[model samples]
Target chain A: MIVDSLPRTTLTEIAGMAGGGAALPALAARLNIVEMTQAAEDAVLQPKDAGRWPHALRAALAARIARQNDCPALADRYAGMAGADMAVADPAVAGEAEGLTLVCRFMDKVSVSPRDVAARDILELQEAGVSDADIVRLCELNAFVSYQVRVIAGLRLMAESVA
Target chain B: MNDVIHKFTRNVPDWRPRVTPVKLEDATPEQLDALQVTPSNTKVSAYVLTLAHDVETLKVRSPLFNGIMYDPGGLDRAARELSALAASVLSRCVYCAAVHAARHAQLSKSTEVTDDLFANGDKADLTPRDRAIFDLAYGLAGSPPAATPDQMRAARDAGLSDAEIVDAILSSALFGWANRLMHVLGDPVRKGAA
Candidate 1:
């Protein structure tokens, strides 16, 4: 929730100022990162993935982790995706709940104490039927989210300094 | 202080990765595109290739990353490398720590400086400007993240411009993520090993 307390006008101005000049290149790079983040989220929640994991369930897990990490913005974003009416009845969630939860647990661990992630953690995912491909994707998402948190934190710090 | 830095001093890898990488031939189209081909057709490092498992993210990651770490403006190469090393060392990612440590040495042209930093960052022999940068980098790498306001003051007092400070933030922050990725993805092994 790094963006939560900021004025919408100021943010718009920041976005606007990024349109041209020396800032343009950096802005474009940041915008691309934003798009990439969106794309990854979309891929994770896309219908094709519904068979393996429901978007809502995944979002719920993300929301829970975001809340734990004190990222109000991310928490809110994920909670919205999780939706008001949520349950584990979806076969994807019911069947692979353990695997999914483990991924969530891994995200939580990596968010703070990344060094603690042991070989056993990866092994457990494999034992639970999470394919190597899935494990890789999970790591990617976890890694990206961890990056996102710091990036946002840094940006917020920058913004606060200017403000 | 010595306990904080990575213990590896020599026998670093020549061109080998610590972990099993996704071979280029096995890469997806997106992953293939993630490779940064130079005039001679060289590509990104083995570490990046291993990240091909998620090319959608890598595409954006590459550009933002290049801009922050390798772009020609803002903090000088040595200072940025110092920021990178500070973060990598504290994060305890031996792979990235070594890369940046070597780069810092090469750019600064002082092996002893790099050695001092790796041995004990806080006590590293540094100029006033370098000390300021290190303070911020170490602060950012702290568990709860050192106080931003104070670090900013220290940087400004040490004579860094806003843009330079931004570079410091970006350099250190990128490694915050990078180190975690290396730690989770695979191990960093010594060269000539089975």
Candidate 2:
């Protein structure tokens, strides 16, 4: 919900999805990694695991993190999707108390500083009605976002030098 | 088969994470298949079993991991492992750090670099070439904002081909996220309980 859009060029617009950097091989590599990322997101956010974690919840949590990380493009898309299903976002609209609050809280830890998280922190999620499977999915989603944000940001940096 | 098959153990238990992984007896058929063997057809390890708690995601995760680490087109296994170690070091993930460090030493057969890296990655004994991976990956993993073109240039200066550098970024970024998951899912123990 707090995800604000920032103006920028998307990788696809810049390089036809794989955006070239200085070298052909480097460009290929970035494109390959980006393709994997796109595929992974489609798998996670689409119809596959709907029974466990809804697409909406995934969107909300994803948007929250993209916002936290300053990924405007990703934040805008996921936040828009999350808007419909946020039946009861926290007072801060930050995903508290709702089963998602637990996800948001934990993932926020993951986003800011993962080293500080302890077993007790995970237990709080379990107590909040998140199953072990859901917990794993949350971790997967959060971690993937971390990877995605960094890769894109780094690639964006590489893209700037593109001709 | 991956060496992790033989190396899996809960020995280095940390009291920090408390989620119980699905043990062998409780594993599902899907997990049974997944935990049964490594890519090389050797017996799988407790690590796979532990991950069986969420077999579906593991189904999705393992192949990607294999592609990045074991796929044909990227950095050699040693350089890939080096990138992983750099990220794990940044995440301060003991479990992953231990696993990848051993792999780096085995693949490179260069104990001095591996040991120095493990001891203090901030200043490993690598030449500018090898050091490029550390520079690029540390910033990439710790804080993407901190990562800059210089890190990539540094990797290039160290004599890594563009593809190698790409692999370096991919592997390091993978661990940046992965280390976080491992940290929350469970803590690493030095040895399994006897």
Tens-digit per-residue lDDT, B1-194, candidate 2: 11111222212333223565676666667777756554576555555555566565566667677778877875789888878888877777777876787787788876677677756658766878778777787888864346777777676666777567668777887897788777777766534331
Question: Clash pairs of candidate 2?
Answer: A95-A101, A119-B16, B11-B191, B11-B192, B12-B188, B12-B189, B12-B190, B12-B191, B13-B189, B129-B158
- Distance from true position, residue B159, model 2, in Å? 2.4
Predictions in order: chain A TM-score: 0.63, 0.74
Model 2, A1-163: lDDT tens per residue? 2212221233343322333335445545444444556666665565365556788877777776666676767776776776666542222465444635566667788876887777778788778777776677777777877777776665665555333
DockQ score of the complex predicted as candidate 1: 0.27
Off by over 4 Å in 2: A1-35, A85-93, A97-99, B1-17, B23-46
Compare the candidates by DockQ and give the number of the best one. 2
Docking model 1 quality class: acceptable
lDDT of each: 0.60, 0.66
